[model samples]
Target: MQKQREVGNRVFVTGIGLISALGNNVAENHSSLAAGKDGITKAVHFESLYTETLPFGEVKLSNDELKALLHLENEFGYTRTCLLAVKAFEEAVNDSGLSAEELSSFDTALISASTVGGMCLTDQLYDDANMKFEGSEYLEAYGCAAHTMRLIEKYKINGFTDTINTACSSSANAIMMGARLIKAGRAKRVIVGGVDALAKYTVNGFNALKILSEFPCKPFDENRDGLNLGEAGAYLVLESEEVSVGKRKYAEIAGFGNSNDAHHPSAMSDDAVGAIISMKTAIESAGIDATKIDYINTHGTGTPNNDRVELFGISQIFEKVPPFSSTKSYTGHTLGASGAVEAIFSILSIQYSEIYPSLHIETNMEGFDAAPITEFQSDVSVNYVLSNSFGFGGNCTSLVIGRVN
Candidate 1:
């Protein structure tokens, strides 16, 4: 007995689950964002080269609580990253109107984005064998691919389970892939988003890059430093039009664009050529006015060079930029998880009929005189929001979330 049928391939997000540094689930996260609060704080897990020298958005869930969510038997070998994913995935599936069995009625896919997957577990494997060593019993399944597979089996989804590792733009790109699947009539329902747990590899990598901040991150401030790392996993349930008949829909994803600078492996081009092209393509695909956009969720990592180039790129696009904010101050840099986490935040703004501020931008960066919304505003109708994500290797992506309904 099939519960739903696939007709038109239009995709709508009926369910969302997120656990970040700010809060564990939707209610908690919404409260934190509403109060203009920040989640960046001291590192509570793992030793790091920049432990005391840097801050991060670490979730407060212990391994025991994480294990309970998955109802795993006996002791577990999963890493902190996998645990976070399990928690968020459970919430997403539970919130969606479709039950696991009902979702199995049609082609369902679980496509996720990740970077430094299962990092905490990998770190433990390399630690001193004599110091509480468990011999890495299940070390093989902790990476990105295996972690995703674990979720697919747990949920009994009979569709594709894959990982996208496009650096920071991974999950945002996941949505683009999901849209393609729907347009091609590949699946009636899909789960798309990203997950990442804080790890020594990421902290040390950022420290080596000299972009890890000790205090809170300031996106476009003149005294802005670097970003604070964080841990999170968020998911979106995308149901095709035919399957979404009775479900509440979120904002529509109108257009998306991705491009690589090809200039520097670790740095974005000074001219922001790639970013500009990506924004242009996304807006063009949406077939909307540049000035019609009401908000922007910037990939503002609070780094020096990144701010300059991003602001320059925005100014180049329109004569006047729209009200913008960076939710990173509230969630830290969730890395691969950032794109999807921020995407949900953008959609929330539309659903709640409000706008969240970019927390730490106090002053404009020197060369870029662009403005940032530092205070929360409401009743401002948001027709479209531009969410940007740019990462190492010059990878950049832009998505235009619109209210064409």
Candidate 2:
């Protein structure tokens, strides 16, 4: 019989890096959260009719500049997707304090999450009439997996790597996958995260859905409209027990769950069936009761249906609803990157005991009493944090991050 996997392998997070509209790296992101700053601004990165028509949390990096910083191969056409990811990856690797030579000591791997890889490159190619592709090589790389391969080669770290594209839940699912890999003894150390840069496609797609909010998103608010699209990349390196010795471990990925409502292509079930199942599964896997969840990082996208359904799920399950926050208003809806972006917030919450508030909350929606802590808060002891990420296709994930030692 296959050995019943107890939480035998202790997976601890050692390194973290973030690049969001709110800030760059850990310090900036943390400070923005504290100041209750909303990073949503009018579109300036790309020329779009959606400019002020739709606001976004756009990063301050340009594609050419990013390629130079990452020292990307000239032969390979770099996109905003790869640029954002490498920025976060480099920061996380530095935070881990492990050089490329040192990484050889452990079985390290990368699992990246993204929905559109080189689509930005694909979209912008038309602008350059001089550019020509005689071979179909660029076509395959246009898909989301292309960035994962880029990350593996760029970093010179080797083990296993794959890409996940479960919409917004992608990176949270990536975190779960890293822990599973460690649990299965597949890799000792894993760099798992997600990255996505703002593009007209996503903006137009969500706009077509009529859910793109022009103003800053106000999740769980009575006046909340919908999410503001954003660009970002956030990554964390997870290490198994032996690999984490002497490292400054931030928090432990205690347990995680990924479930699907499969109810609709874009909309979630009004009853939050998927979220309920996912939360229960995650808490159980963490070997904790619902009451132990000290804080929750909700998948609050500021969407009309999501806010109502998610709150309903939390209220129905946890007895004393934990103080929850959605950093989306600060970073905007980061598409696939939202999962990992918020995971960084989740870990920071555990480390500093700071409850990052959900910005732009004007009023609480009916039936939801656990509204966001509109004002910033600090210095709270939290043992376990339930970070929830839900995405299109009803893909829902709940990750339990616990403080180490």
Candidate 2 regions off by >4 Å?
A: 1-5, 71-76, 102-106, 125-140
- In model 1, where is the ten-residue run with the lowest total lDDT? 1-10
Candidate 1 colliding pairs: none
Look at candidate 2 and give me any clashing residue pairs: none
Quality of model 2 by C-alpha lDDT: 0.84
lDDT of each residue in 1-405, candidate 1, tens digit only? 111222346567778889998888977888899899888887776567666767789886666766776676474667777777877777777788668686555488888988988665655656533456655665665577666876876677777667998888889888878866876788878888888888877777788899877789988888988888888999888777888887778877777788989888778898999999988877776667688778999999888888788888999998888888789989899998888899889888887777899886667667655688888998889878999988788889898887637
Cα TM-score of candidate 2 = 0.93
The TM-score values for the models, in the order shown, are 0.93, 0.93
Q: Which candidate is the best by lDDT?
A: 2
